[model samples]
Target: MANQTSSLRSRGMEMLIAYKNQPSVELRNRLVRLNAGLVRKIAHRVSHQCSEPYEDLEQIGYLGLIRAIERFNPVQGCAFSSFAVPYIRGEMLHFLRDRGTTVKIPRRWQDLQKEAQKCQGEMIRQLGRQPNDHEMAQALCVSVEEWREVKMANKNRMPLSLDATVCHQIDSSITLGDTLPDTYYQRMQLLEEDRQQLQRAMAQLEDKTRSAIEYVFFNGLSRKEVAERIGVSPMTVTRRIQRGIDQMVAFLQPQALQTEP
Candidate 1:
């Protein structure tokens, strides 16, 4: 079996080399079709925290594969997979980092995040240790379910501003107001409304679309990662996400206009 596989690979290499010299639309299409499984395999391996679907990753990987095939030099005696892996992975990672960083977090959620951290510290100080969810809820004077919902709503909280002072530490003199005014309370209220509206809008999406958005944005998984987890084509994942976003934009536009007054 190993000998037969080696023989087949050798033939494939020869075919690849011949096609490389005479690269054409037909050749590129044929190569892509023949190496479709290879593209998918590379995508599965490279996708880490990316939110783009595996089909998208596969498409990117296929591009790498084409480059590899076109640039393959049998004279170098390098294995095709060895040369292609890094190229494929790099292409996918670049797309994820560039696109994923642009997602905007609501300002209200940012405030809630700061408050939650402060609340957690206060609870710890009073209890003399880190508190469990129940303990934290009790300390905050809220139900466990409400606390969980708050945590979920603020899961995408961004990093704290470096300019902001540390408010409290055992025996520390720093305070939050030493840097910025306490306007986070108002922001948190607005954020809560936005979160509720987003949740309602998400509920209206198709199941797959909703799930894809949740995993990609809420859980911080890449599209390729989500596609692999759900056992679907990455292209399907992309389509669902686009459709979902279009629906959300349409749904939110009227509300936004009403609020303009």
Candidate 2:
């Protein structure tokens, strides 16, 4: 087994040298085929106990493997597998961070986080102390409540460990999974009902108002984002949102009260 492994490595290195200079697509594909197992190995390692689809992880890992092939230096005194493993694993991790969440974050929240970090640093230097949300909001020319929402959204970007214990009972222990919002069937049922009710209410709204509500809430966009998407001013988007909410309440509230025990 060791002798076969050594021979394969030698052949791979020879192919690398030839391909680096001539750069044949055929040679590159051959290299990928030879080392495809490496990609799967790295993918499996990175995704251990993760719920992400194995095929998707492997595809991401293949991208990293290709990157490694393009950049590997024979003179770096490292084996090809050693050089490629990090790249493959890094790609998988990057994919998980960007796309693994059940609730997809809005791009606006990510942009807001960047702006908040920049403004927080500058304000701290100017004031010689950490600025509060109100100060930050005033500097950013946003409302304090809006600033708080942004901050909370940014804070939620950090992924929590599932294995973390949420509670300790007399005879057993409960993990964070046990307490997660997703674990509640009752809550999910209620949410589904609310979603159906909202959809029905939205169907009754004007086209423009419906679009505004969908953009702001369902699409996870800010009022400004909704305005830009719909080719309207932010103030107009806000009015539409308010009117939509009022209409939804009028349409759904009586039903909700009737269902109350």
Report lDDT per candidate. 0.75, 0.85
Q: Residue-wise lDDT of candidate 1 within 49-76, one digit each (tens)? A: 3435667888877777777777777668
Model 2 regions more than 4 Å off: 102-261
- lDDT per residue for candidate 2 within 33-113, as digits (tens), equals 999999988778766646566899999998999899999878777898989998999999888878766555566665666
Clashing pairs in 2: none
Cα misplacement distance, residue 78 of candidate 2 (Å): 1.6
The segments of candidate 1 whose C-alpha lies over 4 angstroms from its true place after superposition are 102-261
Q: Candidate 1 — what's its lDDT? A: 0.75
Of the candidates shown, which would achieve the greatest lDDT relative to the real structure? 2
**214, model 1: CA deviation in Å?**
65
* Cα shift from native, residue 151, model 1 (Å): 9.9
List CA RMSD, all candidates.
24.5, 23.1
lDDT of 2: 0.85
